[model samples]
Target: MATQTSIPASHDRDFYAWALESANRLRAGNLAGLDLQRIAEEIEGMGRAEKHALASHLKILILHLLKWRYQPTLRSLSWQLSIANARDEIAELLEDSPSLTGKLPEILARRYPAARQGAILETGLPAATFPTGCPLTVEQLLDPEYWT
Candidate 1:
């Protein structure tokens, strides 16, 4: 019988190796739909260290998705890339500094306090009225009265 070990199998392999292999496979030219659930499960099973190594690779994957989905301009792409890099750096910093985790709640509260309640107006706006003269705008130009 195999003994149960606290150390998971993913930890047995070097994180860089696993991350690189996973990224290479993901980046390989393929048009077929991916099994996202299965891929997520596989990543979830990885050890903490592996997860950290994989963050950068995952960031790249997200950037690719953003680029494809939005077809952003080069300037927009550069800005987004910078933001992604900053996010990855923050993740690395948090992972390396475990002590920061303890103060996360306080830090978050300080950075973003709870939303304040605001009173809502119950009054409704009056219906809009069109100008008496012939509508010069496209919307008015298309009106039946303008055509008549």
Candidate 2:
């Protein structure tokens, strides 16, 4: 039998090594060997990452929708593809973490202002061109057919 080499739990030095070691330690039933604090932090960090990703994709999707609706003359394949890609990514995230679906309304509401500003900046349109609040519903944002 090959002896499994153990890695040091130094999160600051080598996170990849630490993660691998943590998993190995966990599989070996060595709870005492685990870096409890760091592991907890990493787990929490993962949830935060998922939320951040959801927010980012939502922002991009909203930004593109804004552009598509307000700047019809400037529409391109890129914007359409961006909208599709963001939706696909968000769908995948939700599929993997259904619990996040419940958080969508809040995430969208929080992310919309930034997306609206992004649309303004990208479209070179006045802030007034876009609604102060998101005009699209969560359903419309996710529905592939809504804007098409």
Candidate 3:
């Protein structure tokens, strides 16, 4: 049982304690004491955070791939490791949330410009060197062996 005074007091002072307290309350059938509003929002935020993480990893992976393709002479182990790591992370994310697969095409299209600009800064290549649109499809981007 949670200390009576610790219930509300711990919530504002220490988040971990608050979470533990909340779990205790929930498991003990003390729904009346839960901060359901905050818990609901946090749960919602978790989904959005996963989506954002997927998009971010894809962006970096695509950027490095553009650099790899456009600046072949400048390629190094770092880029190879980045692409491989990103692919692994993306695969793990998809394995956990297969539903997000449908969103990949949109995410790739939306994030391509950022990837292109990132490539420009890293490669010092003219912006015009990269196509105005993404050159690779989501399938191509995710393929481990597809290095152009």
- For model 3, the superposed segments whose C-alpha errors exceed 4 Å read 1-5, 9-12
Compare candidates 2 and 3 on lDDT and give the better one. 2
Q: Please, what is the whole-model Cα lDDT of each candidate in the order they appear?
A: 0.38, 0.91, 0.89
Clashes of each: 0, 0, 0
Better of 1 and 3 by lDDT: 3
Tell me how far the alpha carbon of residue 44 in candidate 2 is from the true structure, in angstroms, after superposition.
Answer: 0.7
Where is model 1 poorest over a 10-residue stretch in terms of lDDT? 114-123
lDDT of 3 by residue, 31-51 (tens): 995789987886788788888
Per-residue lDDT, model 3, residue 109, is 90
Model 1 lDDT, residue 34, Cα: 47
Tens digit of lDDT per residue, candidate 2, span 48-99? 9999999999999999999999988989999999999999999999999899
Q: What is the C-alpha lDDT profile of model 1 across 1-148, one tens digit per residue?
A: 9998653223236656545545655799542444456457766665454544434333332333233233333335654554455445545655776554454444333322111000001112121221222113323211223211
Checking candidate 1 for backbone clashes, the offending pairs are none
Q: Give all TM-scores, in the order shown.
A: 0.24, 0.91, 0.88
